[model samples]
Target: MGALETMMPPPKRARLNGVEIGYYEAGPREGVPIVLSHGFPELAFSWRHQIKALGDAGRWVIAPDQRGYGLSGKPGKVPDYDIDHLTGDMAALLDHLGVEKAVFCGHDWGGLVVWQMPLIHPGRVAGVIGLNTPFMPRGPSDPIAGMRARFGPDMYIVWFQNPDEPEAVLGADTTWTMDFFMRKPAAAPADPPPSASGSTFAFRDLLKMWDPSSDARERLLSPDELAVFADAFRDGGFFGPVSWYRNFTRNWERSATLPGRIDGIPCLMITAELDAVLPPSAAEHMPAFIGDLETKLVKGSGHWTQQEKPDEVNRLMLDWLDRRFPK
Candidate 1:
């Protein structure tokens, strides 16, 4: 733990756009609004440290659990979870807060949402900040086609987009899935590799490979921290979060309607160096889509940069926000 961790207060929930979005807010109510969006398989608690740090800087920060994760309203229908619904839910949250425009920040899938927000509702965004994920320009063909071309047969996207299969594969073992996503990297392989693409292991087994030493494991997340995540997932299940991957084609079709360049919006992108899923290479051509962009690479971090390195993440975000909206 660090200074940022000590200052974090528990989160509160609110009913926004028919969904009870679990959110954490800090600083004065009348301060400049900064909306923080969480990624898949995560909650607004992911921004716990950020909420405290940025709030102390005299900025109003609101981190929402979005529609489908945590205590938020998790609708049953697949169509209800589309990109339009996701982005619209966010816009409605802003409306509920009586905010005309706010600094929008996102991570992972949330990054994808914020990237499209300026294009979809240019009027609602004052500035943009993306963590881990980046913008990829869509061409004449489908977006997944390019990803498939790059990653080949074993790609997670292919499995995730299958609709029926992932709900079973992922949902069957929610604990393992959560551990696989949160586990840190390892120095060596513990056992011989499995033959098949889907040969599975227990979540704890996979985590052990990351670091055999119990002390190292303890440092990453205490039992209490792990319990916090487990309780949320155990209660919510994995269907809603996994459904995010199933929306790729829908997003592409909707995004196809937007123009090539979106001007006048200030953008900031922070790349996680160790992010295996959305590598830094994906961001190579981002400038082609965004008009004014500022990018940074957060070294020694992975997909969960905000949780992994809160201080560095907060410093970059606060500096960028201050520069965009000076005192």
Candidate 2:
């Protein structure tokens, strides 16, 4: 087992905005603070490799469980997971830590939160970096409405709107869900039957096709590394994590005015060449929305860019940090 396999420390808790947040801290006491946030079905352990690298490089790093996952307080209401509340959690964390502002890095849904942070709590972020997900400007309509109209109700995000059904379906077997969701694109086969020509496809339905018997962690992570995630889900259940999806439209409505507006915040977006969920193409228009943006594509990786290709992700992030926020 590699060092990262055991890198995650026991979570330390801090009550922020009436919700208790669980987070792991590392690196030098006086180093620049960087808050790393994890996405759906992920905990701070998702940043284990990056934490080790950055900590070794003398940067202070904190990876949180966010609002609803891990040891953090899970506010059962879907409305509580909106972007403003999500971004507020980060700002509050900095306050709790006595940090004026910190570099923020996030993956997957966490990436979405970081992008919104600069807009929602601009003063609390020194810089922002995204993994796998990119900045998508708010459109003429609520994203959920457009997604439902285009892709229909079976779409993952749309399907997540109902609340209970998905929670039961995904939570029925947490271990299976974790193993299934963590499949790296390079290792897993595409859904056998392709989507109808020109019609939108349901991502959740496609996920149903994955072989539950095949544990992706075997190829992607050590048993210990995988356990960290599995244990968290087992304890927290899928409600809080899935609740993130339930707030798509609410988040869009909350951040509508900020999108497409130029922000001087230095941004680094890293895409995984093999990520189907947040494909590299999604970033094509980012330059128009972000004035200071740098993009990197990690070949041979999937949605779990930081975990699947840690070394590459860390190198790209640290290099960007040194250049953007030099010590």
Highest lDDT among the candidates is held by which one?
2
Q: Write the per-residue lDDT of candidate 1 for residues 1-327, one digit (tens) a residue.
A: 642235455657777666777766788776468899889778777787898898889888888877878878888777677788888877888888889888889999898888778877788989889898887566777766765665443356555666666656656656655665665433221322322443232222343354334523213444556555666787887678877767787778877788666679899989877776666767878887788999998887766789888999999999998898764
The clash number for model 1 is: 0
After superposition, the stretches of candidate 1 with alpha carbons farther than 4 Å from their true spots are 1-11, 145-154, 186-219
Writing each residue's lDDT as its tens digit, candidate 2 over 281-317 gives 8899999889889999899887888988999998998
Residue 186, candidate 2: C-alpha displacement in angstroms:
3.3
Which residue pairs come into collision in candidate 1? none
